[model samples]
Target: MPYQQHTAKKMARPTGNVRWMVVGLCFLGMVINYIDRANLGVALPGMAHDLSLTPFEQGLALSAFFYAYAAFQFFGGGLADKFGPRAMYTFSSLWWGALTAATAFASSMLSLFGVRFLLGAGEAGAYPSCATAVGRWFPKHERALATAIYDNGSRVGGALSLPLVILIVETMGWRESFIITGILGLLFAVLWIKFYRDPRLHPTLNAEELTYIEQGGARPIDPATEEKISWLSLFKFRAVWGLMLGSFSLNFIAYFFITWMPSYLINELHFSLVKVGFVGMLPPLTAVFGGLFGGWLGDHLVRRGVSLSVARKIVICIGMLAGSSIALAVFVPSGAWAMALLCLSYSGIAFCASNSGSLCLDIAPTGRHVAAIMGIQNGSANLAGIIMPVVVGLLVGNENNFSHALMLIGVFGFIGAFSFIVIVGKIAPLTRAKRVKVADAGANNEITH
Candidate 1:
């Protein structure tokens, strides 16, 4: 498949590192994405106290976002694939940003749930779009590192939001915190729409950069030439199921801290809000290194002549096994010890998590299907996101003890690892042969040549 589909319009040869600029935008988008999500957890202490929320009610509020987020992943990915990443990303960011700001106006629990649900629906497109864009811009070799840089936004956001959200809530009130985060998203949405483009379509992209991307094997899918793979056909491939189930397991741990960590710090550990802010930042901060390490390791192994498929799987398995330390944290006695253990747990999980994102590109049927693959995995993962908070609420039954929940989370970390090892098999582009194949299908240079 040619990276560029439309060749009628003459274009200038591109110059400079315009592709990295796209990566920068993606990195920023991710930061904004998680900051919006994580801010709620940090501010929940104040918000819950003011609103008189029960533990169950708090869980409901926490999970409500995922309900819509999960539901829309299917829609978001399809839309992004159909409409293009720039438009979908812009709209998704703006909608979520508006909802985050509107959260300031929420007067009751019902109102809050509605706002969060809508926010989830809007943000659903964010990652799929990012994935699709990355598939378009970077080749197989650089993808792990590229994925790490952008996906690190989640950890960085988690790390920074701890202090930033708490400070804003302490000084300006929780409502103001939402508004501030919302504004940040809106600003980034504009920058994304302003600057991002597929390499061939980009005005400023020169021959050097385009050649680098194409040579790297990050070939673009042309809608005009490729047959649409039925959504139902995706399930026949084990990689699809593996990704869905594996992500479900991995995200379980991730959503936990973002939704519950501050509360855990304050209620069980006896940390004040200020203390929670400082203490809670540890795991996510460490995860930044974890993400980098995982990405680098996979790429490094590939450079050392391991097959790409094996390199990715090895990284994922190692990361997941390391993440099982979360289960061990439950046995630790001190808050500081638990924090240290969690730092290890999250680092390992994130290392695997970054590879998982890059792996979607590896296994996509075509560039057009990148967002779709991402959506399937993320949607399945958010099933955990939607269920975990509520499950923890039930297990704890109005107390702060997360022992039962934590154990279940640790189990999932292993499940993610095991699924990747056994079910995913070889990591390569997956598709059934078309009944009526187009000429020169998957030719790799349909337009650029």
Candidate 2:
């Protein structure tokens, strides 16, 4: 389809960085989104004490969110595709924000579990919606950087939550922390609804900017002529399955930080809550740079004439291998050494994550399918979120030793490296075979349709 002609006044040259503005919104949304999710982990100790819950039960609370979250990813992608990112994002943020505040009211395990499950459902749409927006707004060359900018929220939010949530919990109480974060999300939802729009439909976009985006391969709004692929058809590709497995492995290691790291630091290393507030932030803070670097490295490799396949796979493998260092933390003698190893592991996971997200856009068959494919990969990957917390709880039963759990996460990082290297194929859009139809004529003859 041809680029949508701008009837409004044209600029001599592209003047506004509107695309970057969209990326900035996505980044802010991610930051708010993660703060809400990670707040639970940071506040878990106090919550558990208040509720009289055991470690296994605490794991269950964490896992509950991922159950609905995992289930909704594909569906959320479809919604983003059908409804557009602006609406989907607004709805998701509002839904999760309300639920995050409601979490403060939980009186029992069942109530907390129910609230978290619903919170998961509300938050599930965020990443897929952002993926859809990025695929549509940015060119192929800029996607990794754009994705990294937004994806970095996961680390930044996680990093911020350590001290921020701890401070809130320490001063205002855990219940109030939820209320505060939820309000931030609600405010962001308002901002997103007011400011976001499709680039073609954006009033502030200049002709030159639009042309530059189109010429550089930004996917325009879906045209009548574009062929639509069914969501289920995505499963037939081997790369899809490979991405699923690879992401699952990555998340297995990554979720440990989100769900269990605080406990490990406090219970095993004997760090005070105040100490954890300052010290615990280091690993994820390191990851902020790692993700940015990974995005730059992939884009740099492509600019230098490396094959997309070689470039993406190289970064992914290197990240997972570096992440495997988490196991080494168990052998380190001091808390400082252990923190360094964990930082290496978390940073490696963040490095791999930037490109892993880009792979969704890389392999999507069309612009329409970008979010659907993202949902599929993310849906599968988040199963680790559901399983890891419970597994760690069981492994750390009574002893509070995280050695076994650390080794397990390390092993999965190696497995993630293997999946990327061996299971995933060439980094390119998938093609589906066209279907032929037949028409029956009075049960006597059949003709191609």
**Best of the candidates, lDDT:** 2
Tell me the tens digit of each residue's lDDT in model 1 across 222-278: 777665677766766667788888999998988887898888778777888888888
Q: State residue 143's C-alpha deviation in candidate 2, in Å.
A: 0.7
Q: Cα lDDT of all candidates, in order?
A: 0.83, 0.85
Best by TM-score: 2
Alpha-carbon runs more than 4 Å astray in model 1: 2-15, 224-227, 434-449
Q: Which ten residues in a row have the lowest lDDT in candidate 1?
A: 439-448
lDDT by residue (tens digit), candidate 2, 272-383: 9999888898998999899999988987787666777898888899999989999998999999999999999999998988888899888777778888888888998999
**Candidate 1 C-alpha error for residue 145, in Å:** 1.1
Please identify model 2 stretches exceeding 4 Å from their true place: 2-15, 433-449
TM-score of each: 0.92, 0.93
Model 2 global lDDT (CA atoms, 0 to 1): 0.85
Residue-pair clashes per candidate = 8, 0
